[model samples]
Target: MRIAVTGREGQVARSLLATAPSGIEVITIGRPELDLANPASVLPALAAAQPDVIVSAAAYTAVDKAESEPESAFAVNAAGAGAVSEAAAKLGIPVIHLSTDYVFSGEKLAPYVETDPTGPISVYGSTKLEGELRVAAGNTDHVILRTAWVYSPFGANFVKTMLRLAETRDELRVVADQRGCPTSALDIADAILAIAARLKADPDPALRGTFHLTGTGEATWADFATEIFAQSRALGGNSATVTPITTAEYPTPARRPANSRLSGDKLAATYGIRLPGWKSSTEIAVKAILKNAI
Candidate 1:
């Protein structure tokens, strides 16, 4: 099967390309070739690739920066996403779009389900929610996979940031009030490929809709950093002392959700795919990064 993914350098797109199964052709487009912000580039680029399925992985992901640049965020996350879905619809192909757990207000005491009413707390969340709506409206054969706390060896994510900071700092203060699952980009890529294969084989209505795809467990930023240090220590890498702090202590332009945990029961029931625990996935990513560093 041929799969066309957006954002060649993104964490998810890179993971998909690196771990794609044999016998599958994966073509990635980004920047000059397929800029999500430019609607005119969507159809022609996708048409030339002629993919069996489209994975809409590109987005303006600067959470704090989005607060100052809402227009750019909407242009890429909302309108650009809709344009991709529309192109997929015209080509009569399925499009799997990655979304965020930020869609929720994060007030729920329990993990969020797909049916939960959305109440984004920040510009990033709001734009992602709008993108979800637009993609659904543009194409019926779409799978909106909402994930959270994504990190991997590639890209500028929490894991890499923590490691980089540890090089100079003796102690790091992380927000303890905010809690969510730390999903590995590699795990997400695996799920996306599985979904693509299934969609290519069978266009089941039961499979088309929104679904929560994340790591099996949850943790606060403090807890996540602590684990990262623990894993790094085991790998003979630099480790820092993690100090837990409240969200109010460290303010940002964008207000983060206090609890953005998403349940993966629906995805498990439908796709029979469940991601590994956050700790295991973190260890895998940390080890990979450390290995590459040496």
Candidate 2:
């Protein structure tokens, strides 16, 4: 299957390109070729790719920065996403769009289901929620996969940030009150490919909706940081002591959800796909990153 993915250099897109199965052809376009912020560029570029399916993987992901640039976030995450779905609808293909856990208010004590009411706390989350709405409205054959705490060896994510910080600091302060699943981009890519291949052969209406796709387990930023250090130490890299802090202590321009955990029951029931545990995936990614460092 030919999969046209947006965001050439993003973690998910990079993982998609690297880990696609033997029969799948993954083509990524970004910037000048297909800028999400520019709706005019969507149709022509997507038409030329002539893909069997489209993976809308790109977005304005800067959580804190989005507070200061809501317009830019809306343009890319909302309007641009809608345009991609519209173009996919024109080609009569399925679309797999990546969403986030931030759509929730994070007040829920338990994990969030697909039907949970959305209450985004940040501009980034609000824009992403709008994107989800637009994509659903624009295309009938769409799968909105909402993931959380995504990190990979290829992108600027929490894992890399912690490792980079450890290079100079002996102690790192991370928020312990916040809790969510830490998903791996590689696992997400595998899940996307499986869904795409299944949809290509049979576009089941049962599979066309928002589903939570994340790692099997959950963790706070502090716990996540601790594990990162553990993995780094095992890989012969620098490790730091993770000092637990509250969200208030490390305030940003945007307010993060205290709890953004999502349930994966729907995805497993429908697709029989489940990502690895957070620690397992983090270890693999950390090892890979450290290997390159050496």
User: Model 1 over residues 1-294: C-alpha lDDT tens digits?
Assistant: 999998898999999988998898889998798998999999999999999999999999999999999999999999999999999999999999999999999999999999999999999999999999999999999999999999999989999999999989999999999999999999999999999999988978999999999999989999999999999998899989999999999999999989989999999999899999999999999999999988
- Compose the digit string of candidate 2's lDDT tens values, residues 1-294: 899999899999999988997889999989899999899999899989999999999999999999999999999999999999999999999999999999999999999999989999999999999999999999999999999999999979999999999999999999999999999999999999999988888867998899999999999999999999998998789999999999989879999999989999999999999889999999999999998888
Worst 10 residues of 1 by lDDT: 17-26
What clash count goes with each model?
A: 0, 0
lDDT of 1 at 37: 91
* Worst 10-residue lDDT window, candidate 2: 198-207
Q: Clashing pairs in model 1?
A: none
Model 2 TM-score, 2 decimals: 0.99
